[model samples]
Target chain A: MKFSATTALAGSLALVLGFAAPAFADIKIGATISETGPASFLGDPEAKTLKMLVEEINAAGGVNGEKLELVVYDDGGDPNKARTFATRLVEDDEVVAVIGGTTTGTSMAIIPVLGDAEVPFISLAGAVEIIDPVKPFVFKTPHTDRMACAKIFEDMKKNGITKIGLISGSDGFGASMHKQCLAIIGEYGIEVLADETYGPTDADMTPQLTNIKGKDGIQAVLNPGFGQGPAIVTRNYAQLAVGLPLYQSHGVASDGFIELAGAQAAEGVKLPGTALLVAGLLPENDPQRAVVVAYKEAYEKATGKPVSTFGGYAHDALRILVDAIKRAGSAEPSAIRDAIEGTSGLVGTTGTVTMSATDHLGLDLSAFRMLKIEDGGWKIVE
Target chain B: MIMRLSSKATTLLILAAVIAIAPFFFPSSYYFRVGSLIFVNGLAVTGLVILIGYAGQISLGHAGFAGIGAYACALAPIHLGLHPALAAILGALLSAAIAFLVGRPILRLKGYYLAVASLGFGILVSMVLSNEAQLTGGPDGMAVPELGLRAVLKAVGIDLSNTEFWYAFSGLALVLGAWLALNLYHSPTGRALRALHGSEVAARTVGVDVAHYKLVAFVISAIYASVSGSLLALQNKFITPDVAGFMHSIEMVTMAVLGGAGSVLGAILGAAILTTLPQVLTVFQEYEQLMLGLVMMLVMIFMREGLLPSVAHRIRGRGE
Candidate 1:
């Protein structure tokens, strides 16, 4: 097609000038998600869930008699762009609360910007550092890697497993979880007999698995990674006939992992995951059962896609933020922030949240349910 | 000669006026942040103009220098006990030294060979930054200390908002970068660089050390990229290894080429357009990438000489 410089210039000019902020008496909630890049699997559903919740909330006559205006910017998983968007959300959109930061990098990048602005930010990323020291304005909804490690070790302790081989992807999530697990393994009376790591894009993990399998006293194997790495490890474990129970981190708490690793190979694999992964399996009286079931149904029906734990993080974040905003009795940033901090006994998808000044995540080990892959689906194991 | 001097002065004047006056029209402080980002990118692209436009040497891994600069800012304050401002200088010096060393060998290669060699260097830097989780925070990245100049300015009764402070600081940096680059354009070394760019053999016969001039341009450009990275790290107070990623190096080159690689003003305009395009296109949401690609494609098709130079050529054509 023939193109003209004048046309391109005029088009760009129109786009730049086309942004006209509408007058809104509603509360503005902002988000900066990694909506379109390498982290899109996490951020796409997150953006969808946030948009769906905002619609649902507004449809129910909004929060505190005011409609919610969600200003979401796609950062394309770039931390620098995420920082810019976080600043824009606070300084330009003037949002009372933000519910994003899809990746750990983006979360850390956005944290200081929101902290400086004193705008309450509930990140969806699963990183312990996001709230370890506990920034005043930063909160997260997902269970952290540390919590995941503790949950896995608790299961192993119950099983009377004393020694295990540790294999992790050298990516951010795996490395952090590996460190967290090692730090607390001594408390669990478990010895990591063999610890190994594979590169993120390593097509074959057989060498690492072989090395771990050769350890004499290893009772089980644990893979702490997300994406296809754990699936590859799982397959290699089965191929090598390791004859040991394999544990995976919450990073791969999805059906896709089973499908990728093959259902047969994935059978008997255990991991700590959110209740959203087993919404139908929860007992009727469980507090999270209703919330998770409702979110799963709504998300599935709206997007025609299966509900993921990633989206559940966004669901819990929005619900918590909106609930806090409602209880705060004001849309003031500091008020919303304090309300988020004081959030207690709030039942949501990730589990009942009870945030304190010292604990911004508000989720304990109970937030992660130990589930075994059985019959090609998740089976709640405790 | 007068015409050449006037053109240089005009470029600087236009750039300065835009930096000084654009904030007045900004709807919010967010625009100041975006403007500062453009200037930061412009500083780096100005440097590329020296390497690619002046010396005709292609570097596909200049972002490696940028990574060093950014990490230097993040690591220096805690490890070396240097102030953030001084850390930026340390970063620039380190980048220059690395560039000189790397350029010495790799600058011997021509065209695509050099491009691939530089690209490997960039990937190697990013791999280290990503793998060294203990120091660089791995892929999650590390927080950068504040430049702390704003507090000093406030103490002197000239307080500016964080975004405004960065906007003014980065704008001044860009102007200085452009001034230095324009000065180099007319200098004997720059002439030698340009002469080599035109014909290496002819320039060599005319006593122009082709290899030395190329190395000089490469080192200078690397310093510009490093300083740009340091400014970005300081202003945002956060950074990830993505600064040194291959895509960023491509972006620097794209900004220079798309705006008119041969001219400092043109390259800065390219940087401004590219940086602002993403911000403006975010309104497209899902279609943002499609629209961005389409715009860049169209610009490349129609403005073969790049956005600024082609338009300038048309204006000059009309003047006749």
Candidate 2:
């Protein structure tokens, strides 16, 4: 044991020395991700796709005739880890850009590192504040809770739902909805009859559902979630036998949610997902239809599985950044930042993205397509 | 033990000198920035040495205090209309109060009970911070008001780069904290706490107010954590709930243990090493967490007495 310990130190010393005199390195793009931990539900797959996407970028003659070297650090869905990784990337690796933060909380932790470094980043976390206070350098790919609120309410308006009830996850995701649902629904002249919340790892959202069900004029349901919270809602919504339209946040719109919620429980449950999720059901003439289908084919061929919006987003995120780098003809962070800000009509598997100087969250309400679960498959409702 | 001091002090002076003068060799301003973070983290670990090493009590929730300090910077201006410096003081006071209240009950419990209770307390604090949107701006995080200290210093003919200021300031803070902790290690109360650590029952038989000494350590450590957290937020100008999370608390403990928790200087060194290691290991970014876990386990396995104390003992024995 003593010998091995000494040898290990020696090996690390050698490794350090080896790094001192390196060849001209590739454009180091760092990503802080949750490769392990509870949120690995999303982060594990996100990590896998990050690797594949970087490999693909390099294989295609690389970006700007230089191989794209991706440096990813696992945050384990932890804010401290994300902060540590972010600091390391900016200070040590001196990477040109940063990407990925699986959980909302972790992304929040990394804000200081990016802000201090002024490194351009494309954050995978869906929180608006992650980009809001410090724009120009930070960009987010996913839609915000406010947009989700708007999209869900828009569907409620279409369905002639005058009264609504809300259930949300008890952590940051739930708290965002709890605060915003009333405001967003109020704008549509819809009344919120009840607001309920469930713990993130809770196996049952029934008591919350039962409370919401008791409220008068409850014509529909709205639940915001990412983990099992939505699945619990879907199951409880069915068991209650109350025949009212249910509107869910896009978090539960994943195929895994449907499978977990069971087929019968999912029907008529509406959400604001993308055509990319169930592109097979999208019309052939739809613009995103072809892009999504190609992605599904490529993803399936590579991972030997069906394509998720996760893989789609991961692919698009790297593509957009690499495209920006190639466009700028330099790996300098400011140039890439400017190029990203000016991006318009860039089509991806999900939808056309357009970023502006003011708004780093590139996706609009239109980026989402309203869908209702029908016949065990998500079909367009509007 | 008498002879160990001369050798240990020499080693410590050498280490401090290296850190104080190391930036001249930095290849870029970036190195200065990273070195500043190491110093900042080292300051926090120095506080942990007082709690974990001298007091011989455990706290699995120091990060909650850090959150208090960070959010104070972020929330003080927006919520209470207070300046950032006063907010930092407010954060430290709040952390001390909270630690005092929680430590009263938990400090009496030994071993895993204290660990679990402290862990629960930390999780609850973090949850409220994340869930309370109206006040904390929720999990999306809020911008911290910038510290005008450097600007103030500039007005007084004190010219320093942001990186240089943080490195020097954090280094000074760590040195002050370490000096105080070292003094306390030799004080009457410190001796009592160390006696209690050796045997709780024996401590009581010898007229040691074990509970009071333990609570004092907990509160002081919390104040240290809060100040470190404030320094972090002020430097970065952003704050988030993640500051109070479980992993951060664990990382603090790990650094304390790695540095030879018995001495604040050793803890600071541990903090510096871990802080810089991952930055240099960018090529193995994917394995960063795995490496941390491995290093922590290896250190705990072999370096039972900790990095500084153990190494000093070996050198003293060789000299003898």
Docking class of 2: acceptable
Task: Give residue B262's lDDT in candidate 1 (0 to 100).
Answer: 93
Q: What are the per-model DockQ values?
A: 0.50, 0.27
Model 1 has an lDDT value of: 0.88
Local accuracy of candidate 1 as per-residue lDDT tens digits, B285-319:
66766776776788789987778888999999999
Candidate maximizing DockQ = 1
Please give each candidate's TM-score: 0.95, 0.88
lDDT of each: 0.88, 0.77
> What fraction of correct interface contacts does each candidate retain?
0.57, 0.24
Model 1, residue pairs in steric clash? none
The TM-score of the first chain in every model comes to 0.92, 0.88
**A1-382 per-residue lDDT for model 2 (tens digits):** 1222233346446544643233265788888888777777667666677777777767776778877766677776756557767866787568999887777767766766787788888877776667776566878777777887898888888879888887878766777766666666678988877877788889987788888888888999888887777887899889997688888887776888889989899888888887778788888778777777877777778778677776666666777798799889999999998888877877676567888878776777777889888878888877
* RMSD to truth, every model: 3.2, 4.2
What would the DockQ be for model 1?
A: 0.50
The residue ranges of model 2 lying beyond 4 angstroms of the native Cα positions read A1-28, A64-66, A80-84, A87-94, A105-118, A131-134, A206-216, A329-332, B1-12, B105-116, B157-159, B199-207, B280-282, B285-294
